[model samples]
Target: MTQIQNPIIPGMAPDPSIIRVGADYYIATSTFHWTPAVQIFHSTDLANWQLVGYALNHGEVDLRGTNTPAGIWAPHLSYDSRTQKYWLAYSHMQNMAGREFNSDSFAVSADSITGPWSKPIYLTSIGFDPALFHDADGKHYAAILEWETRTGYQAPGHIVIAEVDLKNGGIIGDWHRVTTGFTTRGCAEAPQLYKHNGYYYLLIAAGGTGYAHGVEIGRSQTIFGPYEPNPTGEPIITSSPQHLFSLGDPDAGHFEMFNPQSLMQKAGHGSLVHTQTDEWYVAHLMSRPLAGQKKNPLGRETSLQKMHWTADGWLEMADGSNLAKMHVDGLKDVPVHQATTQFDINDDFNNDTYDPRFMTPYRTQDAAWVNTIENPGHLRIHGHNSFFSQVNPAIMATRATSLDYTVQTKLTFHPDHYSETAGVGLYYDSNNWLYARLCQADTEDHTVLRVLQAKLGERIDHLTDEVTVPNDTAEIRLAYHQGTAQVLYRLTDTATWQALGTTLDVAYLSDEGVNGAPGEIGGFTALFNFIGSVDAHQLTSFADFDYYTVKNNLERGTHL
Candidate 1:
């Protein structure tokens, strides 16, 4: 048997919705508070997945002023044979303050997976994690969590199913609750409806989204009815399989449920797919925390688990264990194919277009701000708002796919004022990030490079004595290993890299470290290595980046 490693699509890819069409397999994961929302990856072989593009690349949604964990949630991808269109359903979690859990769901369809998708049609404001199910009878349905805010009820509420009119985006009838006591684990959400062997199955993510997260399933004869939980009464796939009922707890940081034996923790929110060959697999989200800590700097990632249908028609892991594994069985006759968009990225900026992996936060990337054709061989990013703005910030970033990684970029910028700066560093959101920038010093006609840090909205200037930059050009590099980051710089092109500041503790960049609101759980998005610019002075300043390179050193043992 061939062994395939877990986390096939690593780093910041979470809440996967997988589907198989012909010989191709695709997985769509959530991208909260990030532009080009709703990440979609393709894989010929299940073991190796490559990001094709995003569904919301067009201006279908505006994430301006969106909170850290309150943008795009679980994006459900499905293809309708009747209409010959691909449908994507997702929730826009607007507010989480005071436990309101306010959300609005929408759906957009396209003829192709990566294409000019249609305008988004508003679905409902019931709750989040909306999934679309097209039945054999050519009718469509949507299942979602009906968020309960009552004083004494199940914390997150019930999984309800509704018949939806896809054309007009309206519900055919009232929502019907289909689950009751499905599993011992509580905080159930992310409902996916499927038809299998004369039964309608509902797969859910139980035990919240933390260490006790797991995949649980139920079945019923009708589309909307009382579904029976799996006979085992346990999650079919999870990192911690021990019994735990956290009904009233909506927090995503159940740190006490951490499983020490498992290398992949918080493995849940799974999407099942039957391959072209006679094989079964589940694409789910898993997290690899820091070695000695419970913080997942890489955030939730996409993993694959080989599954088999029991004789009684229940889904279970092929190994007959509830524990999730770091390595599992692969396809029998399929050869592993290398991913085109691997973890290590080196963009020379020679191409006329920017790398598809590049993404921005809180705002869309347009030719007005970021473009490559203007400079031919360099990516020119015009400054917008400062890093503290939730509206618009000119920053090009990609997901930090490994705990041990180094980011290098050569910046050619001349800041007219201290308020206008440009450089590269790590970012979690607008309120939390680390920036190494080149700006005009207090002295006349002098440029300096300095390091700035933001932790939970508090700013700290780490570099008191800044290094002066000659001709306002320098190469900035950041080496991050196991939650600590070191900023290095070289004045000349061929000069050796020298450390600029002491090692900064950045483990707080993880999901559990940055809190969004007063009562909201920690952030959902992970850390991103970004090349950003800030213009508090004026928006006329632009930064030119010659090249951007990121090398993940996890396999090489954390050597910078």
Candidate 2:
């Protein structure tokens, strides 16, 4: 039988919401702090997925000044058979300070999957991870987590359900408070509603979003009524399925529940789908940490697991175990074919358009700063602000998909001032990045290449390896092996590559290492390889890029 690999969509693709429209299957994942929010992937075989397009690419919302792990969260995708429309529901996490967790939910629709989606219809701000469910009787409903802010109540909140009007964005009735959770593992959120065989199944993510994360299920006869927990009294699927002593603890990372035996951790927030061949699968978020370390630089990725319903109507893994596997049997009797499991971005900047995978942070990309038409053969990036600035910065990046990889770029930059710089390197967020760029020296006589590092708002410069370039053009490469990053550069096409800096420890540029205060989760965005320019003085400097390439060396199931 064919085997489907884990992480069908890798690198920071979390909170998967899967739905089947005719023969094609689509999954939408959360894109926090990244502009063109809510990435949607399409797959027909379930083993392979491809990036189709985005739902919010036309600047329906503002993400400027968004904090780490705060922006568009938990995008839910559904198809309305009655209207023949595709619906997307998501939450805009506006604040996380003091655990106030103020968020607003919105919905959009399109006639086709890759489409001219409608403008966002205002939804409720009651909670995050809101999902829209369309019943067979042509009624619409929204299921969400009513965030509990009071000091003494059940910690994170309750899973509430209410009838809604999709056209006008109004709730028809009062929000019904359902169970906080159906299991011992609390912190319930990401509620999805489905009906199977006259039972309304409510799927939830619990046990936080860390080592103890798992997918729990409950059921009720009516759409809004008392629900019953799973008979096993534990998560239907998890990385660590064994009973935990610290149940109901409101901590994000329950490190004590880290399963020493499992390679995949933090497996939860699942979305289910039934294939055209009558096979079932659950796509959820899972993490693969570096060997012997809990730091997840790749962040929460999307993985798939085969599932089957018992005669008694309880969902369970097909392998009969709750532990997520690295490989599993694919859809039965489906024709197996070679699929593109990984992406190696090699852009020549010759096309008139940019790749869909290229993303900018916080704000809509400015045509004045980045343009491909003016230069024709090169990507012209005019610098705006430094990388730390939340506003406008001329950084164009693609997701870092592997722990062991090489990212190289050919750039021609003319820096007349010391504040102007442009090059390619790795980035986690505005607060953490490492870049090797061409800039003017303090003497203001010649141009030089330098390597700079930022960790949690602290900047460090490697002054010893700075090299004087004869001209304005250079090739820069960032080679990463496990947690160490090395910067190399060559002045001319014929010159051999020379080291620009010492081997820098970059493990601290991960989700766990650069986290926020206590009780708050760290940034879950994936590492990115970016080609950016910075002109803090006049913002007139521009960098012309000939090409950018990323090669992944780590094989599946080996390094991961």
Q: Write the per-residue lDDT of candidate 1 for residues 1-560, one digit (tens) a residue.
A: 67787778778899999998888888999998998999989888887777899999878889999977889999999999888889999999999888898999999999998867889988999999999999989999999999989888877888999999999996899999877337877888999999999999999998877888999999999999779999989899999988887667665567778999878899999899988888998888999888798878888999989999999899999998888888788888987754433778899889978889898998999999898877888999999898888899999999998878899999889888878999999999888899999988877488899988888889888658489997889999999999999999998988999998689899989877787333333777888999988888868999999999999876653311
Which pairs in model 2 have colliding backbones? Answer: none
Compose the digit string of candidate 2's lDDT tens values, residues 54-76.
Answer: 99998898898988678999999
The C-alpha lDDT values of all candidates are: 0.87, 0.86
- C-alpha displacement of 47 in model 1, angstroms? 1.7
TM-score of each: 0.97, 0.98
| Cα lDDT, model 2, residue 209 | 83
lDDT of 2: 0.86
Q: Model 1 off-target regions past 4 Å?
A: 337-341, 516-521, 557-560
**Best prediction by lDDT:** 1
